[model samples]
Target chain A: MTSPLEQKKIRITGPSVVTANRTWDGAVVYRTAKQGWSTELADSAIVSTSDDARALLAEATADDVGAVGPYIAPVELKDGGKVKPGNLREHIRAKGVTIDLQVPA
Target chain B: MYAYDELDRTLINERVSEFRDQVKRRLSGELTEDEFKILRLQNGVYLQLHAYMFRVAIPYGTLSSKQLRRLAHVARRYDRGYGHFTTRQNIQFNWIKLAELPDALADLAEVGIHAMQTSGNNMRNVTSDQWAGVAPGEIEDPRIWSEIIRQHTTLHPEFSFLPRKFKIAITAAEHDRAAIKIHDIGLRLHKNADGETGFEVLVGGGLGRTPFIAKTIKPFVSGRDILSYIEAILRVYNQYGRRDNIYKARIKILVHELGIEKFAKEVDEEWKAMGDVGLTLDHTAIEEVRSRFSYPAYEKLPHMPDELKQAAHDKLFERWRKNSVSAHKVQGYSIVTLSLKPVGGPPGDASAEQMDAVADLADKYSFGEIRVGHEQNLALPHVAKRDLPVLFKALDRLGLATPNVNLVTDIIACPGLDYCSLANARSIPIAQELTRRFANHDTADLIGRLHINISGCINACGHHHVGHIGILGVEKNGEEFYQITIGGRADENAQLGTLIGPAVPYAEVADVIEDIVEAYLALRDRPEELFVDTVKRLGVEPIRERVYATR
Candidate 1:
């Protein structure tokens, strides 16, 4: 039987990357091209297919050197090689805070 | 207001040192994520969606000007220059780095504050009526007993690893400002027939997936024996509270399963077995705590100051005064609740500069004291009536003066899916939308005393179960949906809200609320009857019909 986490994993239709919060600061990070964690989403190792996404997620989970709860989340690769999270939650996560981050001087 | 003694300070310092070492071990890969999670939670550190969140306890909602300044400094230096005040009367820094938490805690310790027991499956912060000492109809100062409970429960050896998280609240006022009936242990201090101060202890009250109004286990526990009795209750819960099911772990479930009578009998037996094992309060210690919370040096002024009388005629000042000011026990003083719910902003988020300004205002207007009300607002407990206009103007300049306290615009919301990992849907945006929709002061004034509480999940961090109008977010098939409940109240007569209809999409929440308010307006006997009272008189049927009419 598949684990609950695996069962919850949706069918990957687009390019995806394994993302999680960094263990030290809980900042949103992605599994990088060099098998390390990167704060920049553009540097993430994007897997093209479901099998590749699963493999990437498995590798990210097994490493456990820098992140917690690594999971495959879909991302959109822009023209300038910029990466954006597909969902609102992840978008907000990438931005750090939901509301305006500015504080009055 | 109770100043930490040598022992208190030492314990906090030791705890911080211990946590620092724990953090070091975790970062160095000596501790696993699961192992570190428990330790971090015990110290009020949460790994949220974006960053680590650190919650600091404001003991019984009391803070000195110096402590407030320290909080502001922490916000400015460590966090994103802002902090969110919670419904539990605690402040949460959402953008904290885990590595810097130890240093942040050290800074907090200098001001006699710590985050211990603010989280974890231990006894959390001991909250009391915000106007405990100063409220007009208070029987006794509940903060004294709250302080006593805080001292006793802070890292108690046996109860540290309880079945689940526990909360204790105390109220000494005729009006239940502390929401006592909805805590794990709600201690209501009142004068008995013999004119002696005693407690009416209620146990098993909680809000989460399961909401319960606490049952009176012991109707009258005397002042000296309150700790021992509480220990007895805790012992009973520790022994019999369910551990297998996380959902059924709170003491409320245990009390529910065993029945209040059986639970009371077990507590009584436990109390008898303990035989006053160092839990009784000594007169000197009690007096020492009382002395720390002495009345501020109030001047001998007449009942109504000329400035206040002059300001009362000004429409804006009168509007602010009508909503913000409450009668104090002292004739010349008033309890001023500064609304944290500004238009189109998160309900209780305050910037570092705003916190500093509030501290300064407290010093100038009040007696250098600040209070965190359970309604997610700050209070200047002893503001002289003469300084009303000046204080109002200063607050207005800071954008803190939203004359909508207890009105529809004053929403209480949790940091839902936006920040919390456990939340399925967002609460802040919903609160923002509601506040924006109800920005009209005339409309809000017409719909008086409506407490709209939104929780992201069933944990009920927003106290949605006790809200006059409660909104709970649930995810259905990966889409965010909201369930609305009405006729709930968190006052002397506490009742959990009844669900109005089927869950509505997020976009329709404000419309549903408006429809319910319209239903109330149509069905009410008079305008003077409150929304909750009108709902009680006419059942949820009228509102439910209107809400689901088109469907």
Candidate 2:
């Protein structure tokens, strides 16, 4: 099991054009988990291929979601999205990648 | 007190005008709240729970009588006829209107004071040992460097919007009265092997939610390279510090994540780039700034005043000695700490009238010098012993002669729920009630020096974690509850207090504290055993048993 710090770091990018206000660069990125993206904002989340991200992005629509807009696509793990809530190891086993949803440092 | 030169006076006056325009713009809706927040905060204005709070900087804890008089006038005209001194050597007026801030700044500027850089994510007001020039133990005056750093950082455009707010403290005394270890940057002025004075720099210390004692990044940085070294550390933090999470944005988290070795290496790398450029100590500038803080004329006199000698044998003078007098570097002169902790009164509070009286006392008896301590107390750093009787008589009439500067009743408490929007519980009333309960000055003196810090929330504005007897206020079912921590201190030897079992109700806090003190008295080896040593040897078990046993 990879330590949270050892997880592959990826930059989240390009949701800014769709954002209501100024879009940040390399703004949204997540790390790949064995299972699914970790719910913790600090944890690394999995990002699937752009096609999968596009499809998930289409299916998601919520009023609260609209204001913040275009939540990052769910990383479709080879296995499934099911995983323990906070257990990073189990999260990796279920979801291939976890979404790192925050502004870039 | 350091006198402001023409340039200093002009800059402050210009800053007041610039801020007045900004305030006008903000009130006119030309600037939105998001835009105005940073601007207002830079001027030390905060939109708090019930009203706006204006935090004015008392630079390096030093104030002239003119400045204090100006503060009193501001308090009377703009605020609620009182001012609250803070643990950071600043003053906060809780009832100022947003529109009145411009006028307040103007008033402060007229006397060479302003609220610039007291807040915001930039460098804050530089703090030093309150006993800077007068302490016999000091290697050199710390106020010189404090003033230097104050001028260097004030309105430094490039560093304004760093990852988070930064604080710096300098101490020349070995005892560390400035709480240097718990600042963002702590500088201990030390003499090298060759007897050359320089600094021992520490980085990443703070006392907010995630308390950390800064590490020594450089054991010794030459006094000349101080600015370059600080620039390096700040630049590294600015470039690599986490902006993603506000909680982890402090330089401490960066030092924690990357490790201090790596952080220090990065700072070293940056420091090399600015070598011999932008920082060469500009000899003339150093002299220019240093001249403002030059030593005052010292007069030779007998060590003991006959009147004070006769009075010390008196009951009243003995009580005052227990609480008020501290040793001064000059013979026949003493440092007098005037306690604001009157029973049932707010800690750090001074009414406009009281402030005027203090200013009067400073002008008349103490060379117009006043210093504010980090523990929310005020000091007259230079007082002739011969004037003690007259000063004491005047103070006694004003009710400023509490004589419990560092006693159990000298509680350091936050504004808490009464004023602060962030408080989880009420703090002032608890402090007031406790001070009332422990009303005996003699009893407090008997207990010896013990710090009691109370905070409304985990933000630790009152520095509860460092109190010898720390009380943390929490809310339960819309009522106030307090959790006690024992043995915490932020002296030369810093330690985080340990939790003592279950939390207590607000009303029972004073009794619980009494029980804890009584337990210490019983378990201690001798009267020489102060609160910290007693708690250290016996551990919390004895006090825990005594406190909860009553249940």
Candidate 3:
């Protein structure tokens, strides 16, 4: 059985965005309508259909120098065109680690 | 603690240079992600959720003061100001840039540390008992043999690309602190009837989707032929180990399918055919390796010195000493375990400042060497008994003196979904909550020696299968649910835990664990009866009934 990552089958039941990590820095990134990558999820090109999601992911992956592992991730489009991640994983990814890291004084 | 020679130093420097060029090529589109993934992973660079994660090997969990300080510097300079110590007895920097990994590795190389084969499907860092040399009544210091195996297995040509990843653990003490039985290849050094030391070689033990306790294939293999014996086992495995399915790829599966008897026969045949040329560990070769490590100059003193006698009046110091200190082979000394599992904090995490402080403490109280425990803690292996009070106070100031070693609060957890891309749930949060549930140290001491290992997924990175109580996270209906297991243990008689009832929702995990402990406390015949022992006597049904009593 293939894992969810290995399957890579997009089923955009609701609002989604094309997401990846920056190639050099390995930071979470989203594809914008301007055909570029942004670190902010708010700047992502939201798609609701599977076909549109696939197309957006394809376009995002083409920016191999800017992004790596472009895939469609589900999200819940909130008030004022804002997007809240559909799951805990994307929530942490969009922000940072959920727990407070113990940085010494 | 083995000092690096010119050869070891040169290899690491060359590796750093090669990696720099590789990163340059990757950036220039000369190497695709598919090709670069393997190369990066070979150097222990993993693409975690937020950023690239770099894991550095603290080989056999040993580090000198200079090396620890260097790690602290790397934590401050190249990545985040903290690093997570892993159950495999290594340190991982969660926040790292792919562009800067080469430089970080170069800094590590100056102190003879390298991440080579730390992540790939190759020989990982060899693990041993943290109190190897200090623990009393052991056959020998397991690190001596561990270093020998490390040299033999480092970038080994034939075994590098095996069917799946392999892990090896060594323990010389009878207490089995290293959890050797859960490793792919577990070596327990022991004496035969003739009073000659040899290895009790066990193979095919592992955790994950499928868990199995290792079976002893050979009761004894002479010290001289240990490498040849291990090589024989690997050769047989390389030929017969399944690679068609990733889940079934581990040598444990092969040993399970082929049966231990048949597997042992095959290894015996291979060992008979394999010639011991340079592989024999003779006295000269053994002494040569021993000469590399320097021992601490021990001072003669009474077992209970004046300082400790006076300090014992303090209630807090007594609690810390009773729980965190262990007897040493040498008189007037003890092995001190610095708890990384502070309550409500991430297990095994230490800030750069904390690392530097520990380095200073090691140089002060103990020898200038420290050992990382497989249970996600640090050990000061040679602390003078007279200095215990001062060391305790110093560690307390740094918030590293949690009196909960081997207690339920000393939870072992994987980075889980928060950090690991493969996780189904966040283990740290669960561990944090559970540790909070048992926040009182006196209550923890009263409960006594219950291990709770949590894994974010079935990958078993947290060694949940061997925990006295294991919690495995799974995604159910897009929400995290935890499956609880009971009666598991990692010891001389290692066994996998049995699942009890259905999976519980994330909100109910901690309470359910509390209910199980409540049942143990109620059902136990005496105060000394452990949670695992109670489960063994009455079975999980009793505990399960009590846990699901409310539901």
Candidate 4:
């Protein structure tokens, strides 16, 4: 069976952003409009078309100093410059564990 | 229960300092990510989907109360308030920060626990039967030999960077509770006709993308020469094991490529070449290792305790006792398994408060020692029979007394897509839904001794291949699907489960299991026959027909 990440053969749908894991801490980071990585999706550079998404991913991959495994992920923009992940996995990666962390202070 | 000596302490302390320097280099941009990845993995750190995960090995699954308390402290201080006890008898902290990992290792070192060889292509944590010393069997304690192997294999220069990760399991009992047949190297210690204790070495058994039951390479190797034999096997594997393909680099592949006879011949030749080396265990050193295991001051009481007899009449206590309690070698003692599979909760997960409570319970009742079973449950290996009621009450209050050992609700599942980056589906939710479906104690009791193991992918971390009812998660067109297998057994008569039919959707997994169990209920000759036995008698035809027919 093909991997879920490799099964995407359809046309690029709506807005998307190039995201990867920060190399040092493995935190999820997104490529920003200024060619830098940001932890917040709202600060990311949103690409409306497939060509721009591909270019943004190429740029992220070339500047791999800060992150690894860069890939284009779907995102939804909200009012007040907010953004949320378009898939359950990316959402989990952006936030934290799905279950209760329950860490005592 | 084995306390670290000066050499052990020095090795661990030095490794921690070295790792601290390596982490510093990585952060300072002096080391590449590729270089840092190997360094981090060597110390049991992995970069998962969310954050870094650190796995700490509980050698032979034995932990002192002090050690377990220290783990709880680490979980609360460095990570989230809980730790996930794994199927390999290790505990993993999933939310570990990369920067604080050195400090966490330092704390673990203070308690004689290090994350050495928990990952990487070297030898992983050595696992053994949870009831190694106390189980009702006439054999030597396997932990002693496991510790010997651990000491020998830790950072061994020749075997440090094997082609792939190697796992070894030692079981002294005849029942094979440790799932020895599914390990890379399985050592079963037994006595021969002349009453000489030795190990029957089995090699190449593994459950991954390709599953194979281990084959006996050596009929018997003397207890003294077991290390030499293992060294021979590793030497051969290190030389000829596949290194080109990561997927086929495990020793099992090599064993498969070269038949068992040829593999045995190569290992025997290597063993013969290393004649009378220092690898042969000295009796004095063996005795020293054996002396470290602390034995409780067991009192000579009657075979049956009065409290237990009284509790036997109570239905609730009787049910709990029937499921959670096991016969111990000692007359007045019992092996009490604390179920980590609470209803609607993740399997093998314990909160910090629960850890502290269990540690206290161990100190109060079972000689301050706890054992983590490969089944993902904690066992009080030497609990007095008279303290059953109070212990059960304490466990009940902590939500640890689920009374579902080997039952349908006692599910073994891997940290699939929920935590693992390699997973194709989510195993925890499937396990949770199944446990909820079988929440009724009466129903669970009716379906006795049904081991349901779920793995998110073919990696088989959940030992799904050996489960009586195995569930493997797959992906098709971005949707999660589950493949069901039936009649697998992981005991003395071990056999891999057969895949029933086409993969079912995630939504239909629990119902498919229900269908299989319902068919077993209808087709069984009697309730005395187990699910595996019934499948063996009637074959998978009935279950397969029923499962697919319903769908």
**Models, CA RMSD each:** 2.5, 12.8, 1.4, 2.4
Is 2 or 3 the stronger prediction by TM-score?
A: 3
- On the 0 to 100 scale, the lDDT of residue A67 in model 3 is 77
Q: By the TM-score metric, which is better: model 2 or model 4? A: 4
Per residue, candidate 2 scores C-alpha lDDT tens digits across B1-551 of: 67788988999988888888887776565665566678889999875443578999998899988889899899889986888999899999977877778888988888888999888889999998999999998988888888888888888986898888999999999798898888889999998998877899998888777888888889888777888888888889899988888789999889888898998899998999766767767678777777777465667868887878777766776788656888999998999998888877888888888888889899888888899999888899888888888788888788788888888889999987666646766678788878887888778878899999999877788989899998888767545689999998887787789999788887888888888889888888999899999889988888898878868
The list of candidate 2 runs beyond 4 A from truth reads A1-105
Best by TM-score: 3
In model 2 chain B, where is the ten-residue run with the lowest total lDDT?
B26-35
Evaluated with DockQ, which candidate comes out highest?
Answer: 3
> Candidates' TM-scores?
0.95, 0.83, 0.98, 0.95
Docking class of 4: acceptable
Error of 2 at B260 (Å): 2.5
Q: Give the per-residue lDDT of model 1 (tens digit) for A1-105.
A: 011133475568888888888887888889987889999888899988888888888888876648877887778888887888866567767775566544332
Off by over 4 Å in 1: A1-16, A47-55, A62-65, A74-84, A101-105
Q: What is the interface RMSD of candidate 3, in Å?
A: 2.8
In candidate 1 chain B, what residue range of length 10 has the lowest lDDT sum? B286-295
Q: What is the TM-score of chain A alone in each candidate?
A: 0.82, 0.23, 0.89, 0.84
lDDT of candidate 3 at residue B53, scale 0 to 100? 93
Quantify all predictions' global Cα lDDT against the true fold.
0.88, 0.77, 0.90, 0.89
> What is the DockQ for all candidates, taken in turn?
0.40, 0.02, 0.55, 0.37
For model 4, how does the per-residue alpha-carbon lDDT over B1-551 read when each residue is reduced to its tens digit? 78778999999999999999998887777777777888899999987777788999999999999989999999889887889999999999988877789999999999899999999999999999999889987498899999999999999988789999999999999799888889999999998889989999999999999999999998889999999999999999999999999889999999999999999999999999989888877789899999987788889977888998888877888889989999999999999999999888888888888899899999999999999998889999989999999899888888888888999999999988888877888798899899999999999999888999999899999989999999999888767899999999888888999999999998899999999999999999999899999999999998899889856
* Model 3 clashing residue pairs (backbone): none
Stretches > 4 Å off in candidate 4: A1-15, A48-65, A76-86, A95-105
